[model samples]
Structures are given as structure tokens and as C-alpha cells.
Target: MSFGLVARAAGMFAVTNIDDILILALFFAQVRHRPRGVAIVVLGQYVGFAAILAAAVIGALGAGLLPESVLPYLGLLPMILGIRAGWKAWRERHDAADGDSPVGERSDVGILTVAAVTLANGGDNIGVYVPVFANSGTSAMVVYLVVFLALVAVWCAAGRFFATRPPVARALARWGHVLLPVVLIAIGMLILIEGGAFGL
Candidate 1:
């Protein structure tokens, strides 16, 4: 039971970071320099994430979206995602030196762009969590939802705060950008290992 809960949480975290690309792009937009616009983007992310959670819950209640048998296989997705993230990080680092900004390097994107990017990324979260929630027993559903939503809220709040600051924001924009891919890869590999993909 505790193991299932942990598995679901891992799935949610793995999928959620897919939006970092969009968020990264938004930081380069001047809109991020303005508190109001940045807040809107953050709010948009919350709305998108909340919707995914609601959708997952509905899917879970309606039908078994994630059977216990499938949990192990689902765990392998993070490892694949992580590989892509690492690649993206390397690509961005190289591009930056050449004055070629990665997609997330723009800060001038409007509400529509931010919303679109966030929603698209949110779709990945839906795919991963919905199945896990569907297989989760009633005893664990609420716990999973609460943890997932809380994490989303915290992420948005912290993101907004950092988006509004300059020095901290710049440092994140510079150094943290590279770390994002590395973290994504690490999370993916961790999930795969937990899922027993390596048979260790």
C-alpha cells in the first residue's frame, strides 16, 4: 500500500517537469519581469495541473486506470523522459554560448503562449498519473490526490516568487537551467530502477 502511494507520487513528479521547458521560455519574456503577467502564467499552470488531477481522479473512479500489474511498467517512463531531459540540457548549454536561445529562453511570450505550452505539458502528467490513480485503491486515492495537488501548488508559488525576482531569477535562468535536464534524467532513472527495469 505504501509502495503504491510512492509509485503514484513518482509518476506525478516525473511528468510534471515536462512543463519546465515552457516555463523556461517564459522567463526570457519581458512579461516575467512584470509581476502581474508572471503571476498569470503561474496561475495558468496551477489551473492546468488542477485540471489534470481532477481528470485523473475521474478516470480512476470510473475505471481501473492503473492495475497493480501495470505499475512496474509505468515506472519505466521516467527513465526515458530523463534521457530526453538530459539531452535538452546539453543542447541548451551549447546553444546559449552561440546566442541561440532554447525554446524556454524567451520571456516575451503572451498569456496564450504560456497557457498553450503549459496545457500541452500537462497532458503528459495526465497520461502518467491517470493510470496510477486508476489502479490505486480507494484507501489511497485521497492521499495521492492531496500530495499531488499540494506539490503543484508549492511549485507554482515558488515559481512565481522566483519569476518576480531578478538576481535569484537570473541565477536560476543561468545555472538551474542546466540542472533541470540533469534532474529530469536522474528522476527517470530512479523511477526505472524502482520499477525493477534493471532487475537490480
Candidate 2:
């Protein structure tokens, strides 16, 4: 409710989660044509972020639901998902070349997949949020949660806007199958390196 509290919460979320916009944009691009794609993406984001917030809250309460070391291992989730997407794309390409059928416009990016990726990508967020939440009062924590959730919607809308731009959309639509796996793997590697996972 206090302006300072709101600002602090907003700043924390923005600083910690800025990378999410690009990831959401990529997801939006991949699923743009599906009737319920946007809804699914939003839902997936919420689900993932809810998990991150839960962890932070638990850590603030000194419960330590997951050890900090384990966060780096979460990076493996995205890497595996990337490999799976790449394999699927390869199979689809092979099928197309064999005249089995034209490759469909649809994507296999599902809500759970998006949620998993988001959660995996939020390792740094957990690290930052836990301490901040612990230092704050219950009311301040409520404000932070509200601001963070509100900004999630804002982030999703902004991502959709960028992804739907004519040029960007065309590029993504044309090469998204190839690009998605690369992006996912790169993000996973970045997370691992940042967290010093597997000794980098």
C-alpha cells in the first residue's frame, strides 16, 4: 500500500525477471496461431511464477524447501526440453521431405512445458526474492506479491505485442521450429553458467 513498498517490489521484480519478457515473446510467437494460445501462455507463466514465489516465501520462513545448490540442477529441465523439441522438429522435417504431409502450422509448446521452462529459468529470482521477502513485513510481502503478479500480466502483454509485430512474427513463424530449441538450450546453458552448475 505504501508507495515506497510498491516501488521496491516493482523494482525487485523487474530486475530479477527482465529476461522473462524475451522468453514469453518466443512462446507467444510459437503459439500465436492457436485459438487458446495466449491464454495458455499466461496460465503457464502464472503457474511457474507461483512456484517461484512459493519457494521464496518458504525460504523467507526459514523452511528451506530446496537447497540453493539444487537450483542449478533445475537448468537441466530446459536443456532436456530443448532436445526433445529439436528431435520432434527433425522428425517433422523428415516426414515432410518424405511427402508424408505438409508440416502443420501448429506447435507442440504446451502449458506445462512453458511452466516448466519458466520455473527452471527462475533460479536467480528465487535467490533474490528469498532475502527480500524475509526482510519485509507480512503486509509488505502482500504488496510485493500483488505487484509481481500484476507485472506478470504486463510482461505477457508486452511479449505478445512484440511477437505479433509483422516482421518479428514472420521471422518467428518461418524459423521458430529451429530457433526455439536453440534458444531453450542457450537459456539453459546460461542458467547453469550463472549458477556455476556442474562446476560450469
Candidate 3:
């Protein structure tokens, strides 16, 4: 029974977080050269995912910490972050054109930035997890949480593996500045539309 529970948990996590692989890969591409970069990304992922699980657990326990309507507005967080990144990229381009050092040489994405993006991206995961958690017994919920947390490490490693691939690394080094902002904004817009935010 415990093994079954673990398998179920793993399946659910994989189903819900499949998109996270690409996002994590992009993050790894950005930070892989920095000191403690892998640790920072992993820590941010955990902080964000821990918040998601906390919300699910709370909802399962019948405590309404946030209203359903407010969930869609969570999409704004990513949109805002995307805009900030875009502006930074723009500035870097202009600086490079002007013969000044490129601001892109420095890392702008910190742990909180990664955490915010992760949390924003998991809005859908919360919707999926709440009912499953609410229906499960305490032991099942524990198993699910354990499996989910453990898989986060695997996800990070997979992301880093992809980011470090020769072709992928070269492409990212050339175009990641543009791609990151575009992806984040697209994700935010998708979340909003899917959530029916602004009647879209």
C-alpha cells in the first residue's frame, strides 16, 4: 500500500509539473556560471514548492487562506517579473551598443526572483493538488508530500543536464536574454487566460 501511494504521488507530481522542466532549464542556463548557482536555484525551487504544498494542505484542512478569485491575479507576479527582465536586457543591449560594459555580465536573478517565478508558475498545481490532498488520508498526504519534495531534486538535476548540453548551452549563451523574458510573459498570459482572468 505504501508503495502504491508513493507511485501515485510520483505520477501526480509528474503530470502536474511537466512544464517545470523547461522553466528550470532556462533558470539553470542563466545561473550555471555563478557561484553557488545550483544551490540557489534548488533552494528557490524548494521555497516556492513548499509554499504551494502549504497552500494545498491548508485548503485540504478547510482553512480558506485565499479566495478562489484571487488565485488568477497570481499570474501578474510573473508578468511583472518578465517586464523587469526585459527592461534589464534592453539596457544591456544599449550599453553594449554604446561601448559600455554590458550589464548582462552581472546576474540579476536572485533566489527570490526564482522563487517568485516558481510560485507563480505553480498556480495550476495548487488547483490539482488540493482536491487530491483533501480526499486522501493523512498517511497518503504525507507520502505525497515526501515524493513531491524528493522529485524536486531530480527535476533540478534534469534541468541542469539539459542546460549543460553543448548545443543547448551555446544557444542559451547567445539568446537566453531574449528568451527568458518572452517565456515568462507567455507563461503569465497563459495562466491568466486559463484562469479566465479579465474575462479573457
Which number leads on lDDT? Answer: 2
For candidate 3, give the lDDT of residue 115: 83
User: 181 in model 2: Cα distance from truth in Å?
Assistant: 25
Q: How well does each candidate superpose onto the true structure, as a TM-score?
A: 0.60, 0.62, 0.62
lDDT of 1 by residue, 1-200 (tens): 58767666755564456345335334435465565865666666666666777776776565454454555555445445556656776776655445443334664655556556666666645545554555456777777777766776566666656655646655554665565555555555554555565574
lDDT of 2 by residue, 1-200 (tens): 79987986786676556556657877888887889999999999999999999998887767234577766555665576668767887877544233221112336878897788789878756755664565456888889999999999998997789765746544433465576566556656756786788898
- Model 3 per-residue lDDT tens digits across residues 58-173: 87667234566655555665576668767887877544234222222435767887788788878756755665565566888898999999999998897789766746544433
Q: How does candidate 3 fare on TM-score?
A: 0.62
RMSD of each: 5.3, 9.2, 8.9
Worst 10-residue lDDT window for candidate 1 reads 18-27
Local accuracy by lDDT, each model: 0.57, 0.71, 0.71
Q: Which stretches of model 1 miss by more than 4 angstroms?
A: 1-39, 54-67, 96-113, 123-141, 175-178, 185-199
Clash pairs detected, candidate 1 = 24-104, 25-104, 28-106, 28-107, 29-106, 29-107, 29-108, 30-107, 66-135, 78-188
List clash counts for every candidate, in order.
10, 0, 0
Better structure of 2 and 3 per lDDT: 2
